[model samples]
Target chain A: MTVATSDRAPAPAAPDGASRPTPRAPRRRPRRGTVARYAVLCLMVVLLAGPLLWQLSLSLKGAGDTLYERPPRLIPTDPTLTNFTDVLDRVPVLRYVGNSALVALMAVVGNIVGATLAGYALARLRFRGRGIATGVFVAALLVPIETVIVSQFLVVRSLGLTDTLLGVVLPGAVAALNVLLMRNAFAGLPDELEEAAVIDGANAWQRFLRICVPQVTGVITVVAIFAFVGAWNDFLWPLIVLSSEESYTLTVGLNRLRGTFYDDPRLIAAGTVIALIPIITFFVLLQRFFFRGLESGGIKG
Target chain B: MSSSTDLAVRERAAAPRRPRAAGARATHRWRFVPWLMLLPGLAVVITFIVLPFGNTLRLAFTDATLLRPGRWVGLENFERLLGDDRFLTALLNSSLYVVCVVPFMMLLPLVLATLVSRPGRLMGFFRTSIYMPVVMSSVVVGLIWTSMLDRRGLVNETLATFGAIAEPVPFLTDRWLLLFSAMFVTVWMGLGYYMVIYLAALANIDGTLYDAAAMDGAGVVRTFLSVTMPGVRSTMALIGVLSSVAAFRVFGEVYVLTGGTGGVGGRNLTMTMLIQREGTGLQAQTGYAGAISLVMFVVLGALLVVQLWLQQREGRTR
Candidate 1:
């Protein structure tokens, strides 16, 4: 189907050329426009990525090199890995990364399992209070967590879960948005397939596990990425919850690093780069799924 | 629960394809299955979200603090807000932020989406690069921009080199310019994220409509105004509300940029920061913080209703 569409795309332009007063001149006009468009786009890319790249350059430069050199270069003249080594030496970078990973992984697992179950029930089953359940889920999206953070903290404290990773994971374990996305994904599946499984003596759990869940891998992937990234990038909650430096996630840890190394831009830059690498790698490796998920879930900025 | 199950049983019985004996047994067994599936999720929501929200309301009326037991004092916390200079400043700052930032958040993305909606070899790279900031931790964004906007940072250095100014501008220190600088960062971080949304909306538009408009001798601008704008009207409304709500809830950006001081001279102080201060500062006033949150909730809820109503009216008219 795509091939046929691509084949037909050039035909209209050919006929337009035939009808135009000067085919050669008209062709050049579009080519010029295309060039101009690309030029503008390239400029935008630099503008958008420039600061990060500049940080990256600063992160690589040796301590002796002047960071504020005139006609600032994005590529360090004398690059070294000492900044990275210094960051790792000064801070418990590995421990912080591990904490981030553990928290993110727990959130991912909880979101996938919990949201999938609820989403399946909402989409495919005749549930008691289904309307109310869905309404609560939708309303949860509108209640910004920050607004209720004070009480949420008190609750966590009451539960004896504060200063723990579990406390960090539990509140955001199953986002309403992820549940809704999973519901939509489940609803998009063909009912006939599920009905056939039902008629073949499959139980509800069997049907869900074998048929429905497999079909919504795309949504699952999307949910997993969102949950992981959210848990990882989160700063305010972890900052509020975790008191000891040993329990800090990468973001909170980086914030501490900033406070301590206020005068040392190179160390801070290195810490920033270290914090960014995992997520950037995740994005680059799963670029396709990331875009698909963002498109499907309509990610909030 | 029993009544609901009875309704479900009746709903199943009314269907034509079911074999009587097997269907009856199945219905009996599965009556509670959906609820079982929903149990874990509902438990979390009730415990974490619903209860805390209720507690926030309850705490707003009392003089609750970390140590002291609370006693009910109706409207006292809220009445104090009427005269609190810091709360008023935070409210005004948030209002100015939403007003100044939401339009650019909605429109800039539209412009970027239009530019890249056309197919090109580098379109994917451009989209990803622009979106890179959105995926990064806000901590990194705050840190990078804080350094860049410093008096001796790259921004001032570049301007100085270009002879645009004689001295460095204190982007973060100055009172008025601080909010605008924060808004600039907000717009930058959001541009690609919203652009992706607009692109998704644009892709759903039928290509034949543009062809039809062109056939009617409509120019590019005319086609865009008549076809493209209306096509993504719903998305525009969605982004408008989402961005505004997000702006109203702006905390992390301000918190990180100001080193948790809410910006120099409290210029960048937002409502969330104010709430954090009152709730968890050295002299914590939990009740006042709850009142602030409830007020924010009411304000945001009203804004949402108005926007959604406007969108619905627009939809019906179209």
Candidate 2:
């Protein structure tokens, strides 16, 4: 429907399917079919994002507001932050936040470093069992984590890492899919630059770190974002590994909030909203990179 | 993300063989460098995924508990599975999920992708907002729906207000309804994620095909059938495989909706839910869980193989 501006900006067939508008594309009325399309889009949005917004509205409602009125209120007439404060006071919201943040940070850094190094080596350097190494990662990719989870927990327990953040971050630290993505990114680059660097007496490490890594920073960002989101959003793994309340991530802690106080919808809404804040902010700021990296990476559909 | 993941491995499989013997970089000293660089990632993957899976297979044949590693029990656990009523319900629920969810996942996202294909601010807004649910934790998604589907909650209240129904629908308590509700949530969360993949695949579609369709006076429906369908056939098949496997192994939505008890009488339990319930915790009967996991692994593996075979067959038939 927004294709109304296609005349002015001339919508380029970007790899991401023309989502990003060309610069200075002035606003214009939608073409004929675009109107009906926009109506459908709006309805879909209401069906989709409407729930989250409703939750946000409920979170903002004050103690005076009756939650289940005959005609429900979409907006809080007297908006207040008491629900947020109430959830925070009731649970270790900050600790859970910090724990979730730490897990996300670790997963991001680990995937970027680990996936990048292995990806570069696999793509740029040839060695024994290269096919086997690639195969291993591919095989790992096929194994549903759900299937191996119990034994993974046993592995963690054996390593004395259960109930710890490290265990939660380990299995996903170097996700196989990210490694293959990085490998594909590295492989897509022309060999001329690395070949020149090699002839110039630059070692493999130098060629990789100085020449190759720079070209694939985009994929690295993609990996980081995926890892961060995966870690932040993960529920089952951390739930299985970490039993102690102190080690609980935001998702787990929020589930506790729901279990303990199912009556207080406002408080639960506030907790979920609090959990959503950092990730949404992060996504909004870096979504350009997120989609762009995805486009250039030519991620498998 | 899983839709992309299954395709990732398949693409790797089909990727052109890597050329070797590049330059001075192939020296003996550099021989170990690739291995060294690969060590950390490989170590993590092997330790956590590969080795544990091996242990799982081993444990599946044993009567291991959390405390003591018992001796081999061979087909005992598998035999127990035959009589386990919860296991049967879990299998049935998981099968129902795959049947209900996969087709919607394949078709809906492609439509969504086509709808927002053109570039503009509003389109981008739709894209980002639709994809937002994908980024959210399943727990958050589950909780949000749980609140909405409550007895006197948003859905029932709205329905009653509209004079649609007389009594509140038992979404959370009833077993069958809960499974269907979980399926709805699965499709809801998955739409934009697969829509993005469909967007990528849609972009790969040749524009000249659309032009050709138009030149022939092809209607919208005709154009879609002749142009878009063939173009994204493989992607659709890939989505079919990914969504089916994911649907079969569903855990988070059912877990959150049923509040970790797997619904009233645990009739809504999924394969993953069954594994989590039986395989984990202090009194964990890991042997039985391992048997359940082995079955899950094989079922999923068979799913992948069958889909791939079907895709290949369709290609040859075309």
Candidate 3:
């Protein structure tokens, strides 16, 4: 909320001297609008969070409470964490969590390295075929992932990477959006910063690391978050690639909860809650960087 | 700095030489860098994106199967698609989903942006609440919605208590209602992300315009129509195109909700599911699926181009 105030500096300042007298004359008018705005926002908050809260409440219920419906209760008459325990016992929840974490970490590392290098090359270096390359990358953005699924499956099988964590992580490691984001962030850096380093006898790699990388740290964080979430939440590719239950990611594991539906409603709700945790954590951690990066990038130029 | 001075003196000293040649050499050097930057990403795109696209294009023209190999059938797959009733149903369902959802997705975010633009105390909370679902995995969101919209789920239970219905509605399984339910879930999940994009654009707006409009005695609605809307028109255009593409390409919701059966008389089926079922069904028809995908690609590609074209026009208009 404090962030809103920082943004407000430009708001009042934009009116300046011409409207200075007007504000004094009608200070109450702005307050009225502000109050109305807050009311609308409060409604939106309920709309957004209401369902999620319902899910949380359901997850806390005992199995009997879920099925006993003259009407479904918002708050269970008798609550239990036994459902969470049941889910933990029936499925390899911890292993799936580890697999998701491993895949996300590898993808994030791969994307950051590959995108930063590509971003720097596009942003700094002068070379032949630059325009053509940029054009191709932009055009590639619309290539639907579904169109390539079969071929990608074949490609992975041929490489003998199928069913391995690497198969899922590798294909997603370098994305056009990340490269584009990094390039835009790098472009905003002053030329003098790079030139000054070049005069000091820094090589291309050194200049990128010492001068440009620091400047685009915010974009790097944004790209990493995107890559991590993309890998973490992905299901179709992992489902296609991984054959064994021991190797299944959280999404595959959660999907299996559908198989166990008749077992217990408590377990089902518990599993649903468990599946949402990493996603919620991932977003909360990265949103600070995400918002800051977009502000700095100027809405994709 | 010293080397730059030396280089400047050398360049000045070499002014009599082939200066045009030096400038051209530098330009050529600069050109290679972008290609270098593009190489790894291009390789990924080529392998993961272009090669598959090429294969799908070729496969569309052939009689391919998961087993028994493939032969060049030359438009037979596409010809079959034209007459296929299920394909038409899927097409209609997907089209309706996009049409129904895009307006809500686009408008709600704009409304949200307008509300949050006032520099309120809870604006961050508002932005975060909306965006929470965007960052969540589609699969998890699908699972969550499944629970929330189940017959005995919270939504129906809530409606039942209010006596909105005599009985709990078959929200997911009902033929007439399934697609709407899915669209509602999709919009609920996506609203926050588009809001962030709108907020970003709103942040860039010059605040003086609002005061100017106020001085002219325009109220909130008038100011929003004439000032705020135009100010963020480009972002709105971008979000519109992105959300439409998202709506068209939606698979997770349909897959999870209807389990690729397309629910009640195949009414909830989408093009992506049809493509999946064809490629991977019990009786695998890779060539037919490939053909369907090609049609989808062409339709989407044309729409995307139109979207960009409209965005450019709108941007210029603003």
Best by lDDT: 2
Which residue runs of candidate 1 sit more than 4 Å off their true CA positions?
Answer: A1-29, A297-301, B1-30, B212-223, B281-283, B310-318
Each model's lDDT comes to 0.79, 0.83, 0.73
- Model 2 misplaced regions, further than 4 Å: A1-32, A293-301, B1-30, B215-217, B310-318
Which window of ten consecutive residues has the lowest lDDT sum in model 2 chain B?
A: B1-10
Please give me the DockQ of candidate 3 compared with the native complex.
0.40
Two-way lDDT contest, 2 vs 3, winner: 2
Q: Write the per-residue lDDT of candidate 1 for residues B121-208, one digit (tens) a residue.
A: 3456678887888888888888888878887777898998788888889888887877888888888888888888899999988877
Residue-level error in angstroms, candidate 3, position A166: 1.8
Off by over 4 Å in 3: A1-36, A63-72, A293-301, B1-39, B281-283, B314-318
Q: How would you encode candidate 2's per-residue C-alpha lDDT over B1-318 as one tens digit per residue? A: 111212222233344254332333344544577788899899999999999899899989999998889899889999999999999999999999999999999999888888888765667898998887877889999999998999977888898888899999999898788988899999999998788888888998877777677667665567668888889898898888888898998888999999999887888889999999888899899988999999999989999897779778878986
- Looking at candidate 1 chain A, the ten consecutive residues that score lowest on lDDT are A19-28
lDDT of 1 by residue, A38-137 (tens): 5676777877888888789889988668888666667777889999999899899889999999999999999999999999989877654779999888
Instruction: After the best TM-score superposition of candidate 1, give how far the Cα of residue A284 lies from its true spot, in angstroms.
Output: 1.2
| lDDT of candidate 2 over A78-120, digit per residue (tens) | 7999999888888999999999999999999999989999998
